[model samples]
Target chain A: MSDSSSSFISNQVSDISPVQSSTTQSQRRGSSADQDDVILSIRSLCKSYFDAEILQDINLEINSGDFLVLVGPSGCGKSTLLSCIGGLTDVTSGEIFCRGKNITQLDPAKRDIAMVFQSYALFPNMTVAQNIGFGLEVRKVPAAERKQKIQQVAEILHLQPLLDRTPAQLSGGQRQRVAMGRALVRDPTLFLFDEPLSNLDAKLRLSMRTEIKHLHQRLGGTMVYVTHDQVEAMTLASKIMVLNQGRIQQFGSPEEVYKRPANTFVAEFMGSPAMNLIRAKVIVEAGAVKIQIHREDRAPLVFIEQAATDALRAFNNQSVIIGLRPESISDVAARDPQRSHSAECRIEYIEGIGSDVYATLKLGGSDVISRLHGDSNVSAGDRQQLHFDLSNISYFDPSSQLRI
Target chain B: MHSTIKRPRHLSCLLYASLTLLAFFVLAPVLWLLLMSLSSPTDLTKVPLQWIPSQWDFSRYALLLDWQNGSGKRFLAAMLNSLIIATSASFIALVAGVLAAYAFSRRNASMLLMFAFLATIMMPPITYILPLYSAFSELGILNTKVSLIICYSAMLIPFAIWLMKTNIDVLPEEIEHAAMIEGAGTIYTLRKVVLPIILPAIGATAMLSFLTAWDEFFYALIFSSDLSAKTIPVAIADFSAGRVTDFGVIASVGVLASVPPVLIALFFQRFIVSGLVGGSVKG
Candidate 1:
């Protein structure tokens, strides 16, 4: 059983080599030369509300034509930062550069970005055509050209038939489309969206999400989107910036952020049925590292691999945490592998979700979850043996919650 | 089976009884006023307060229109003067209040200054009436329509600004941001977006301003000494204090004085309802 488990650890370590190399290469490429591809650069951004600092030292560079999403829990300053970029709010101190020009004091209209608000922000009194044409009219676009652009954008959004109706006369979904059309008609340099689908029902939000994806693909415009929904961030963003307490916790692609979270917060926040965290103490004996797990009247010491040992060497003889995603653990009785790490657990509950089943079990005085193949005979109050896929385990410093 | 059908029949009987009583309570005074306006003046003093008169007397309303009803009072002139004063004062006050309200709503003014201006609204006109009258006399504006307009408008501006500022405060700031990003400046956004959306509140506030001008007694009594500058209220008050004490004429004048406001309230009743509730709540 230990032979196959060791091979799995070796395989995961081998996979990390290529990922690390590519990341370093990209990092080098960014630092070696000042890439003119940065469409907007925000540096040293700070905001305070009557002495309470909401955002501090926020630095971000948005590349041309990239769809970037800022995601965080509530009150994390994601919306505040977006408003700063749009020039709708005053930053305490910062430099906002657009196309190599400092525009920190520029008004929102002069910043050359259009924002679609969560409430849709459509003029309830105006017809669809007038709302679409309003920006152009304000910019002194010729009436003929305004008509042409309005017609074109209306056709693209399939809003031609509804152009004569006011916003209140339209359904929630239709109002959303009009809001999108209002932003699209301007063809501004940067497009900002603040949870644009949040007001719609579940079905409509899904459809609009797909539509927004299609629009981004078709236009290839630079976008900066904000949402508290991780799924929206995962599916739509080319790059995701996770924020916590007004600071950037992690910034990477969806795959990097999910699999190799910088800390425990990212792991727990990005997944449904959140990751299970168990406390363990680390000890090294005979130049080999092992984690001690204590159960009631029983104790099992599991040896850590060399790679994980190296990562945890700084916390020698200190308590550490083991995080295991629900999918990483399974019922060993269901699948007999060539090798596996087995543990005796007492089944606490079983929840069936059609394609797969989730069972909660007690292991070493803590409750852990395992997702296994369909229809297990396990019920509550039954003793069972569960398998832990050690390859998917994560180690974190127990005090700081930082990934080891 | 028959009693089941008859149950609703019993309910409808009580419903009709209550509704008829309610309608009578509401319509009795209005119907009596209309009938009295058509009766001769001499029959008004007769016993039993005649419900209907034998002859029609349309001459009283004609005399009201002709600007002559003896005792040297000019009703037509007074009505015209009231119209000019109320319309001009209300319109000017509305424009100034809207602009100032926008500033206050945006928090662009100093808090001290805002509170000071708001404090003016709580000061009663009776507190400043003598000083205001003396100032008007010194400025040579006494007994002119402009004097009344300036006085009424000054009195109304503080409350109007307060009302509008509260209304504008409740509107979502995002809509204004959207408009600004659409390339609209302050005036354009106000005229195109903000004004139309809050038109109901605007209509309601305008009615309030007009009503204040129409019903004001102290300012009109102090300022207007001649027949040419007197408003409807002062004219009606003067007519009631005369030697004869014509009850019919007083009733006719009372009905006439209420016509414009009642008609306006009926025409814009929907706006009034929305404005009253909307300004106080979501706006």
Candidate 2:
């Protein structure tokens, strides 16, 4: 299972188009010669309380100026993993190297890591300026310099008017900005955020997310952020690592994780309106492979794979799970003209979430959902023709659940 | 509509009556004490409690405050001793108990130690007095304010720690973690961040400890004999124990003894209500 999925992962990484692949290559070449580009490295990190393991042997490397997002469901240890990297949670047996210095045994303060917590964790007793400058004050920075730096950070976060207001007096977004200001004032080696935007309303979350991304771009600081929101992972991450049950399911660029997931878990977990897993039987017709999806009625729908990989060929006539995302079946998806197949099915219901219409239908003996255009005037019981993008489809072994 | 309009008014009338009854039940003794202190000797001894005094004699209070008088010096010294013991005991208990509570809350220190501290207070005061009396005598600190301070501190530390611990537990650990990650040390974090956030709890604990030490009688009765360390409560007991007891003087002393606590309670009621009592309701 590991062998096949690792091969799939490498294939996806190398499968980027000419321009992206070249720039990726050039970036690697430029960074390979100097170890300074490595901002944080974890070797065999594991965390457990008593006999209950929270994080397994985790190994990762973060480059300087990288926005790495750790995303997973609740209790997947993403925040614990971030805390380990920041020296808040001690590892069972591992070494954490921050900026090439071993910081596993170091104190959290000496590790020089700045973190913005989920609750904002702003000191309730202090004003905004006092809260932002606390780290400076604790470190015995001169009062004049601390004031200047706090003012500078306040200017950056546009918190000039709120400097004298306590956290209880500030709005949620303002408190969030103050938290960011606190982190920014320290100039720590790495920035950590544990679901820092989860507390805000949807609109504020979006604006804060955009502001954080812009701040990262402007400062070019290395950040390791933890969130259970996959959209945040997809939008903010240069490298997104999906975790489950204290293990990394997949770590790759957002496009790679979404387009070509390493395993069925990654395939299902990395997208909104998660990827659909359909039980299908593979058949060889004249030495070419086709998957017959068992529909509820009428007849079985068969889709052909013209460019089947060698890994897929190994499971020629066996039952496999066909991982199909909703967009792959939407009518608005670009047709490949040759490889994209179309099937007509009856819609069960339609849910319009303002931006897109999600139509639920029965296909391959499962309730499959499709992302349709918002203005599409289709209701329940209407027949609709959906297209399948073979290029976007993922094949998983039924028992092992690994991508082939 | 007519019933709804009239019901609240009738209900409020009943409610106010119940409230008045409860308030008088709690305050009737203090009010009677004030009347006894203000009445002349003949008025206090008269039958049917002399619901109204013939003359408002202020002579008992005058005698109590007269430093040149015989019992006046003892009363003033005992009052000073009570002040010294209660304030010092409260201050010491707060300092030590707050630190321990922080450990119990943030450091995940042994619950066994906390339970042991509580077990000391759980024991009856009579049980501690014997051993503590011997201990103080052997240590040559008998009849001194220091011995009483120690005893009161022992009695109050657990209460302080328990109150402080509960209040500290409600504060988010992430706040402290965030401060530590930003280079604040443990003591610094406690003094700056934790102390300020839990100030209400500290206020409540200090107020309760002072009140307890101020009213403590058994330890002061057994431990101190004279002007050196006898507190107000023990002195009041001595006044009542005399064969020819002056009810007016005793009432006046009782009234004077309660003044400090009443003033402190009024000053710190907001903290007490918002801190520990509020936590109990929330929990």
Candidate 3:
């Protein structure tokens, strides 16, 4: 309740850290934690429609209560993958297991999975209560119990006032809530959401996004969500599955997928004001590895990166692409001093959004964006010393376009 | 492409004028029929025709409806027969057509077969009349309501299938997909979900098929010989078949026969507009 207790808790944590760390490491090594916690598993899952392959070898293992988000650009098979998991679509080849039971060919009803569709797909004719209870009703749940379950879900979603209204009579956000309530009433083994908030306006989408995140946190339900919005994927997911061209580019925690992307596509697709990738030559000089950025009318911008040195060492005197997030490159005042490097880049353009300014600069023959604080009023053609957070840098092989 | 600009005033006036003229052209025949039904026998033979009858002789309607009168009993029997045949045929067609349409629209059934069905039903009835007549005769259903109902159902089923399919096609498959995934069986989903949404189409189809059967003259004329199964169209023809025909009675019968169809059209006009437009969900 007060600073003393907060300090005491911190002090207590520090005092026990060494002993706890030792025991936890051994426990982790001894126990097969992941194997027992898996709620859903897909092995060599493939889906095709007539002649075209929609998904290919989508293998995934989801932990219980984890919010797994499948994200990509349009038609990237993320939704298809979610549908495959929900048993809404047939898989061409491979096996799907839920809680260690093979349910690859089970009917969607028989498989205890519920889904909220992109269109909300709320029954247009039924009241919100009826729509929420339709699944239970179909399962032949007792009427009074169905009503109670509907009441509980309605209260959770703040849909009690709208329980009597048909979908056509409800707002988009209200309809989305009703769609979710329908799924929530089942309390199924897994929950699926196929771009549930994509239909709402931007403001509503943001609020609903927060609501969904909060819902998952409060309920601790394992959810597999599909969205084309990377921000949604980054913000809501316990683990993010990045898909491109019907193949998973990477699947990891949001930070892991962002900071250490598996490949170029995941790096570029995962961030807004995308990570700047520039082709540069790696050179070793006097037992030190330095990355050189060559320009036409100026000396090469050279900086020594702290991370990725061993990988960079293998490419001495050879080309490799360096990836840096926009926020990683900022005004010189933002330098961390520990691993930050300074670069003199000519600002090509600038866009201001009240809180910050994004200045586009030509760096190493590539257009790179540097996110600057709003007060740093640098204009185009002005050469500025931008600080790069070298600790957050990534190196990719230029030939394969994979993180080195 | 909705325009804010209003049309030219003169053009709108001309359009309204033409609409009114079209309405007059259509309603004038029905108006004439009503006037003739009220005119006396003497009023009909006056060489210079009176637009309005000098006397309103409503006895013709009474006589046609009288149970004791031979002509009235025949007319009443025909009306009953027409009612039974139209209702039965359209009902059977609706039940069978909705199932076929649900299959064609929802189950990825071959649409080519539906088109083929349409093509076969589109052929002139005369092409099959000889075989139909022989079949009915052989089955001992000739001169019966069953014969006409059978023929009318065959004629109207294609129309029912086409209308129902288009309306069902307009429904998003996601709703059914959601239902199926949520544990609703196929039949339950159709009864609870699809049926309610496509009810307008059902109404329109039923009304249209009923009208189609009600208007059938050739089939009824050939199949029904007398009071046992004679329909309104056959009765109207018989009213003018012999010498000394009572034109007032024929006019009255014509006016009454048109009543059910006009009322049905009025009730179903809104549904028809929507059902037809619903098929354009694609683009």
What order do candidates take by DockQ, descending? 2, 1, 3
The candidates, ranked best first by TM-score, are 2, 3, 1
TM-score of each: 0.87, 0.92, 0.91
Taking the candidates in order, what DockQ does each have?
0.39, 0.45, 0.39
Model 1 lDDT per residue over A191-228, tens place: 89998988889999999999998888777777999999
lDDT of 3 by residue, B37-149 (tens): 99998888788987789999999889888979998898889889999999999999999899899999888889888998899787888998999999999999999999998
Best by lDDT, which number? 2
Q: What's model 3's lDDT at B53?
A: 95
Interface root-mean-square deviation, candidate 1: 3.8
Which of the CAPRI classes, incorrect, acceptable, medium or high, describes model 2?
acceptable
- Candidate 2, residues B36-94, lDDT tens digits: the string is 89988888888777967899989888888888997788788889999999999999999
Give me the runs in candidate 3 sitting further than 4 Å from their true place.
Answer: A1-36, A309-311, A332-336, B1-13, B270-283
Supply the DockQ value of model 1: 0.39
Kindly report which residue stretches of model 2 are placed more than 4 angstroms away from their true locations once superposed: A1-36, A332-335, A353-355, A375-377, B1-7, B270-283
Q: Is candidate 1 or candidate 2 better by DockQ?
A: 2
Restricted to chain B, the TM-score per model reads 0.83, 0.92, 0.91
Task: Give a tens-digit lDDT track for model 1, residues B1-283.
Answer: 3555555767889999999999999989887887777788767767877778888887667667663456324666777788889889999889988888898888487767667877876887788889888999999989999889998898888878888888888788888888888878888899988888777878877989998998888889999998768998998888788888876676677688889888777777876776555432111
